[model samples]
Target: MDLALYHPAAGYYTRNRTVIGPRGDYFTSPSATPLFGRLLARQLMDFREEMGYPAGFAVVELGGHRGQLRQDVLLEAPDLAYQVVEVGDPLPAGLVGCFLSNEFWDALPVHRVRVAEGRWQEIYVREEGERFADEMGPLSDPRLEAYLDGLPVAWMEGYETTLNLQAQEWMVQLGQCLERGFVLSIDYGFEREEYFSPHRPKGTLRCYHRHTLHDDYYAHPGEQDLTAHVDFSALIEAGRQAGLEPTLFTDQGRYLVGIGQELFAEIAERTAGQFSRERQAIHQLIHPSLMGSAFKVLIQKKTS
Candidate 1:
């Protein structure tokens, strides 16, 4: 998965083939509307104010493709400091502000696992005459077993899931670099129970190609996008271990509504004409049936 998505050459993201927005393979909240970033910027502003606007404070965004969110937020809060970092880039040290991300954690490479004979087995990819095939093997790493310790009790035979150990490392990295600030992450995920529920036996790993969703992980090797839903409970626990405190955990819809209800109302009143496109865009962002319910928001804070 890492090589398919991050290989320096012939990879999806590294090859710069990731197209976002209307014509892209998929749409994110920032792609839906600037209001998304605007509302988030408002929250960041509050974070800044609460922290007394510390020196060298900056809003560091992880995997911010094309900077749409950065542009939108800067437009809303012109004086706010902002920085965009790619997935593998070295994060700026001693950051005094927020580490923000949208749909970023889901894109990290994951270890596929399944319950086989009441034990966890890792899924590996092998070459089959120019095609890829899944090959089951023992836990690739002891960390995989440790990370998923005790979670397979209810998983029946053949139940498949993904282990996103990278996300946990990400939290620890953010905790290490952030001297005193918050981490605001927005992505599609679940709160552990739902993530590992019996009802979701198939797990959340999915692929996106030309805006179409499928589970053909082996199709279009380095061209299609692969993702999985995040486990917010795991993230919270990881953050706590890394010296960060969870401050908020909610769906994107509720978070946006809490921060932008009045702003949305004013924008609706002002953009009643041709500019009403933004109003519709905002609806797509917060409407439960759209990207709103599908995405979640998690905020964690750390102090020096």
Candidate 2:
């Protein structure tokens, strides 16, 4: 999965592919509208004010490709310092600010797992005449077992799910890097309960190429975007262990409405009963049937 999505040569992301926006595979909120970043800028301002407006408080964004959010946030808060870091890059040390991410966690490669005949097995890829095939084997890493041991739910035979060990590792690094501040993660995911529910037997692994969704995980390797629904519960637990405390957990709809209700209303009035792009974008952002409910926002604070 990692090689298919992040290989330095031809991976989906490292090769500088058009993997986002209307012209690409998927549309992220930042691509949906600038207002998303404006509201996030407001949230950052609120965070800054709460921290007594600390000097040199920076905004560190993980996987901020093409700087869409960066441009929008900077346009709204010109005085702030913003830094974009790749997934595997070294994070700055002793920072005093927020660690922000949008759809970042979901993009990280995850290990596929399933309970087969009362035993846990890991799915591996194998070469088969110009194609890839799944090869089941023992857990690739011992941590996979440790993660399963921590889950409160019982495993059902043949039921499958994913474990995002990288996310936990990143959280540990984030906790160590920030001397004090907040972590705001926005992505489409679910709590552990729903994430590993029996109803979702096939798990959330999916592929996207030019906005078309399919389950052919082996198709067009290194050319399509691969993703899985994040486990917010796991992230929250990991954050807590890393000295970050959860402050809020909500869907994108409520979070945006909480922060930008008046702004949206103002835009609606200015449109004067005609459907403008601004209003349409706003609807796509906060309406439940759209990207709103599908995406979730989690905020955690670290103080030292």
Candidate 3:
């Protein structure tokens, strides 16, 4: 699964083709409106000020699909130094600025498992009649065993779950690469307790195709996108162990409003004479029903 999504030869991202916006499988927040990137830019500016205005700062964005956010940042702050580090790109060392991602970790391939007979078993995908089918195997990873053991009793009997140890490893790698800076992660997730609630027996794994949500992941193979719900608590714990301090945790709506509301208001007042599409774009971004409430932002700073 990991090879299919990340292999340089035939990977979804490495194909060098446009795969974002309405034309693609799904639309990301940055692709929807520049306001999302603008708000993030505001937070980056705040971080710069906190760091006493370093002579040179790097804003590294991972999984920057089509570089929309990077383009928006440059448009908003042309003088700021920015870098778009996509999958398979080498992360630079001694970075001293903000590292950002939008729905990146969820895209990483995860091992699926189901608890039966008081033990977790691996769920494998096999090609069957031109489609993928679920195949069960013995759980070999010690970490997967440990993860299942930590789940609540309610989730132990014939319930499926995703083990995203790769996400944790990615955090470890990023932590080591970042010398003194902040890691800003934006995604949809729930805290550990709420994440494994009894209501969610099947886990949060979904596929996106033509902007519509579906569970048939094998329908399109490499053509569609697959994602799972992030475990924010697990990420937080991993970051803490990697020497990164959990500085802030808030829903995307609150974070954006707290930082961008004043700027948005000022812009609105100044541009009241012309009710343009830009104003409409701003509304969509901050609207609670839209990307605002659906996403979340997690900020962790590395202790110098």
Best by TM-score: 2
- Model 1: per-residue lDDT, tens digit, 242-287? 8899989987888888899889889878876665777887778877
Off by over 4 Å in 1: 152-155, 271-275
Taking the tens digit of each residue's C-alpha lDDT, what string does model 3 give over 1-304?
5765666777666666566787887888888888777778888888888988887778999888778999988887887789999876899888888789998989989988887777778998887887889988998688877776766743458888787998998898888888888999999888888777777878888988788899876776666678899999889988887778998888887887789878778888889989767778776666678766667789999968
Each prediction's TM-score versus the true structure: 0.96, 0.97, 0.93
lDDT of 1: 0.88
Candidate number with the higher TM-score (1 or 2): 2
Better of 2 and 3 by TM-score: 2
The candidate 3 region of ten consecutive residues with least summed lDDT is: 147-156
Q: Flag the better candidate by lDDT, 1 or 3.
A: 1
Which 10 residues in a row give candidate 2 its minimum summed lDDT?
A: 150-159
Give a tens-digit lDDT track for model 2, residues 1-304.
Answer: 9999998898999998688998899899999889999999999999999999999999999999989999999999998999999846779999999999999999999999988767789988999999999888999999999888844344677878899999998888898888999999999999988897878888999999999999899999998999999999989999888899999999999999999988888997899878699888888998999988989999999988
**Clash pairs for candidate 3:** none
Number of backbone collisions per candidate, in order? 0, 0, 0
